[model samples]
Target: MSAETRVVLRRAAASDAAAAADVWLRSFAAALPTVVRPRSDDEVRDHIRDVVVPLRETWVAEVADRGGMGGIVGLMVLDGDLLSQLYLAPEWRGRGIGDRFVALAKRRSPRGLTLWTFQVNKPAHRFYERHGFVAVEFTDGSANEEREPDVRYVWQP
Candidate 1:
């Protein structure tokens, strides 16, 4: 997993919905095993297909090798000034895919960006912080669907 390996980041299509949802599921389970998911696998895929991909600025990251876009290694969703979601396949975690995605997010939303992450997701907190995001708010497990304590981070640049 060299940082130099090329990654093709492009808008997700309807066909990518299931794969993107798969990345989300794997990343969620790997990053926050204790957190309970409110939706089933099928429901998640359906939501990604119906709502996230079509209605939001969703991007899928794929490895580009031999002139073809390979399997999807990560996915991100951007909603206006909010970086609604950014998830990477478990094995792709520390290989710069997330950094590139965050860079793209910042480029897309130059004004600023805000995102929420579970409080227990320390790796995510550190990753966002390294990308210039600062913790601006924290909330108990009441506001989010996960019912897990969360922290809000904002990047102003």
Candidate 2:
């Protein structure tokens, strides 16, 4: 699935907050073997305030080479060495966009990279494995445990 696809990876600005949230909810909800709350118009705005706004850096992935105005296919939040909330639109999956975003996150966090995924998201677990992340821990107490347990993975290189 790797075609040397060119995607614009750049620091997300305050102006792009809404679009980024849109893509996040869309992709988050569409991922397989997991359940995400369906974000309403209000919820989307609330997420931007509660989640995205707090990240150290929110990076946006766009197909446009110059990073011009367009849809955000994927995004990643860098919290020190931890790469939290990496998501890509379902339509963009398998296109290597998520892989590129992961690479960007790792580069941004050279100390290491860690993230969590629903234990049931086998495809995402495999994707992380392919990127050198190994599961280090698991938790069955997440509020969403009714859907699936959660596993934490880390890559230290």
Q: In model 2, what lDDT does residue 83 have?
A: 82
User: Can you give the lDDT of residue 54 in candidate 1?
Assistant: 98
lDDT of 2 by residue, 36-90 (tens): 4545757776777566755567788876544353567777787777786787877
lDDT score for residue 123 of model 2 = 89
Task: Write down the TM-score for model 1.
Answer: 0.94
Looking at model 2, the pairs that clash are none
Off by over 4 Å in 1: 2-5, 67-69
Clashing pairs in 1: none
Local accuracy of candidate 1 as per-residue lDDT tens digits, 1-157: 6544677899998999888999999989888999999999899989999999999999999887764547888999999999999999998888888888999999999999999999999988999999999999999979999899999999999
